[model samples]
Target: MMHAVVVFETLWGNTEQLAREVAAGLGLESTDVVDAVSAPAMLEDDVDLLVVGGPTHAFSMSTDKTREAAQQQGAENIPRRGIREWIASLASPGRDIRVATFDTRVTSPRLPGSAAKKAMKRLVALGFRPAAKPHTFGVHGYSGPVADGELERARRWGEELAATR
Candidate 1:
């Protein structure tokens, strides 16, 4: 049985729901879907796989301070504020970890896949392989009902990831 940890940050709860579905798909008798902010300290060490996500803020993952700075700068493209900065702060340093990522955002149909690209780059730099494209669950402005197919897609993504290892 594979041990997996799925953690996420959400302002409007859409992303958290997605994380839970990911855990369900893994079908682990022991699994955790936790809020990134209050996550336990040793959450990362023993998992066979790590899934992390948040809403896209400023074309990347959300950081509490960056959202404030963007709000002050009048930037319209910031993602909601959360623990993405904490993710960047982690010092994996040559560790071997398999990771996948996802995000929740309104479908731009115009940004042309920019956020996923940025997320893949960040994940690789943090010593994780880009296992899958970063997914974006939809929202009507900010609070979301999640687009029609988004949850199903997420569930399918989880199954696929589980099958990979």
Candidate 2:
């Protein structure tokens, strides 16, 4: 069996729910998903795959400023540094570790960026191997019930990612 760890950050819980769906697709128990704020500073050495995700803020990963803004606007349990910080907190694992990234964003057709793409870049720069292209799930708005069937799509993506690994 593959050992995978999924870590994610969410302001409105959309991303967290996606994380669980991905984990299920990866054949992992719900306990394998960890919130970014509470994620271990270092990833476990034994994990075969590492999955990271979060909500896109300002077209990219959430920043300290964005997180703060969310908290001030009545968003509860906002994490200080989210996925961007959690990715930074990790040490180079030396051996190649398969990784996949995803993000949730508003459904504006004009929106031109994704945090998942940025996260995938950072993971590669940090020496992890990308198992597949980064992916995004759309929300109807800032606080969202994810677009119809997105959770199922995310799960399929997760399964495909495992197949590639």
- What's the count of clashing pairs in each model shown? 4, 0
lDDT of 1 at 151: 79
Error of 1 at 120 (Å): 3.6
Candidate 1 positional error at 79, Å = 12
Instruction: Candidate 2: list runs displaced more than 4 Å.
Output: 28-31
Model 1, 1-165: lDDT tens per residue?
677878777766777788888778877766778776665545456667778877776666666674666457554544433555546555553666677888877765434343445655776887776566666667555556777887788888888888885
RMSD of 1: 4.2
* Residue 77 in candidate 2, Cα distance off native in Å: 2.8
Candidate 1: segments with Cα more than 4 A from true spot = 40-44, 65-81, 108-116
Residue-level lDDT of model 2, residues 1-165, one tens digit each, is: 678889999998899889988888886542378998888876676788989999888889999898888778777867776889888887776887898999998887648778899999988888899888888888877777889999999888878877776
Q: Best by lDDT, which number?
A: 2
TM-scores for every candidate against the unseen true structure: 0.78, 0.92
Whole-model lDDT per candidate: 0.68, 0.85
User: Which 10-residue window in model 1 sums to the lowest lDDT?
Assistant: 108-117
